[model samples]
Target: MTTAARAPLQLPWRTGLAYGALAAPLAFVSLPLYVNLPHHYASVAGAPLAALGGVLLATRALDALIDPALGRLADRLFRQGKGQGHAWWAAVLGCVLLALGFAALWHPPKDSATAMLVWLAGALLLTTLAYSAVCILHQAWGTRWGGAPAWRARVTAWREGATLIGVLLASALPLWLGFDATSALLVLGLMLGLWSLHRLKLPVAQLADPVAPSPDRPQRSPWANASFRWLMLVFMLNGVASAIPATLLPFFVADRLQAPQWQPLFLLGYFGAAALGLPLWVRAVGRRGLAPSWRAGMGLSVLAFAATPWLGAGDGAVFAVICVASGLALGADLALPAALLTGVIHQGGAGGQSEGRYLGWWTCATKLNLALAAGLVLPLLSWAGYRSGSTDAAALQALAWLYAGLPCVLKLGAALALWCAERHHPTWRHTT
Candidate 1:
């Protein structure tokens, strides 16, 4: 094992907060890109749903495909001489590009359909690429701060908790402050996050290694690890389940529920609940261990989502309850899997050496899930005769089923996969 992997982590709450600060802004940017952008273009910008789906699929798929290479770049930046300095500069560049791309994405030229589509495609590519670079670096950094499973869960909790805050802000701000102000806030949040990271005391000896790869000790690829593959299967299935709801949330709220005004409230309730429930999940991790806690969360999500198809207009209150329930489950989704993956990396003897690569593929699955949700779901909805503001019973039913029912099935599958892994693979038990 590497010295860095063996080093004990002494993460105080203050340092954990500092280390996780950047996640807030990065996630702040993510909510709109993933959740709101599709609705915006389809409804507000008058873009054709099928074409927009095509664009999102192409750009996001391209974005996901390149993550492994970017992960390799991150490894080089961390392994080379003056590694910390190089990584810092890379993050700075990513932030700057992120800010610019975000602005462009939200304020696209609506001169013509062709122009808008072109602008949206370009902007999405730039924003997602920049987001991936910064996010992979941040995740890799956290993974490098090696610790016991419980400690890793705490680190992930801090980061994911801040992420929920960012999600809450993103959910509320466009409604309260408008998109222009929201964009400005994102830039400011990015700046503040970067500043906090600047003040953070990194594990310099761990991250700033100047060693060149020895010919005899070739690095292992993340794909070569069986545990990573199994874990990613569950992660990707679970992510697709989550992504479907996110993709369809606005439409469900606006059309099916006939409660557009309540969108912000629903969003706040969801993410607020997630943020508040993080501590509970962290404790669960400590007590029950990562996989069990994650399975429990999946079960909770399935139970919450099962009631959605029965809901209709004026059932916003009941839906809010569902949101809170599902959001609590979201806390587990956010914290535990990543923690488990950190354990997987260390156990596989990758540790500080290949954290970026593992997390890169991790992030890649995440994007592909979103991409698949948007690319397939939107076009499929359109094909099924469901428009954004439709009140047709069949159409609304389709939307509800896709939004609610599919996720439950997928979540259950993920839970089952996790359970089988636990039963079959003893290494999975030790990863915690």
Candidate 2:
């Protein structure tokens, strides 16, 4: 009981943010993995841009494919407790694999297209699997510790706030210092992540509900729990809304904004704002309640995204403000979903063993969001006469629509889905 309970208090507020510090390195790595890897292959590895893009498409699909099994593995490891099953060890393995993958991809030797493909594919697979496992466990660990609305919000806020700081650090370090600094930060970040993982509070299952039988390892019985299925549906719809803008932001900035200089500025503001605003949102979550707080986030996201299509050249000021506003909205986005998911976990009677299974599904939704975002945006942008670097007014307008309008529409869809979830179900709520 003591050991399970000790998992949550691994660090103080500032130090727990160290756990969030892991986000910086992960995001920094994601820079190359999703956002910049293709570019590197094209320019440095001499892979033709077309071939490189295809390779990325194939490899990323593979990476996303293997995530659910890994998620389930995490569930089992966590189920048996950290020492017995080596849950922290498993997470550390993934973290180290992530860093090594970056190192391998960054400093490749055999500069052939085939070599690059093999190397990139191998690395991406390991990293994605590891990331999915670590994140799912991290989320489950948080959710396992049931609490009041404010405390739950605080738990998520600590994680998201660290992620924001990491984003800022990753953004600034590489730009100002260089890749070597990036490498150093990643090493330090992983150490912190491991340390924090050791300290993170796991739910004292015995204390939580002695009368309520503990959940054991999850099986392939997801829909067997109907409420979990419905919540997942809502999550999937909303996740796609968030993913659309993420996939197209770089394209929008480079081509439409025609102001590459402001790219980092915009991202920094948005992510930085998310880190800063987390505490405030936690307060709102406490006062307004989880359902209402989540509703507020969805509403803000829809409103802020809607304003995106109206900006233009020299609209940096407006865009900057939008970035800040949307990021504040992001604060809620980060905290509430996981909190709600935890509620779902408790309610679905999955409390005994399905943490990993539920989180695995959650990870699947996350990857699907990214895939759908890219699958929808990239092809749509191309079809709309928006090429990679075209500045034609019509093309730029299409870019704006892809970046802003489409996401807004999707966000509204997500909002509607959540409304349905709120009205229809509370099976996940268990007052044990």
Off by over 4 Å in 1: 1-10, 203-216, 430-432
Model 1 residue 223 CA deviation in Å: 1.1
Residue-wise lDDT of candidate 1 within 1-432, one digit each (tens)? Answer: 233332334458888888889999888789988888999998999999889989999999999999988888888888877546778788999999998898888777888999999999999999999999999988888887756767788888888888988888899987788778888888889888888877877653232111322335667888897878889999999999999999999999999999999999999999999998888988887677788889999999999889998899999999999999998889999999998888777666676677788888988999999999999889989998999899899999999999999989999999999998777555444423
Off by over 4 Å in 2: 1-24, 31-57, 81-85, 107-119, 200-211, 215-220, 426-432
Cα lDDT, model 2, residue 27 = 65
lDDT of each: 0.85, 0.67
For candidate 2, write residues 1-432 as lDDT tens digits: 222221232235654454454555566665445554543454456654444445555666666667667767876786674342477778778787777766666665565768767776687666676677677767766666654445556667777766677677766566577666787778788787777667655545422322232445335466576667767777777777777777667667677776767877888898888877787777776466666666688789887778788788778878888898898888878887777676666545566466677777777777767766665566666667766667788978988987888777877787787777767764223212
Lowest summed lDDT over 10 consecutive residues: which window, candidate 1?
A: 204-213
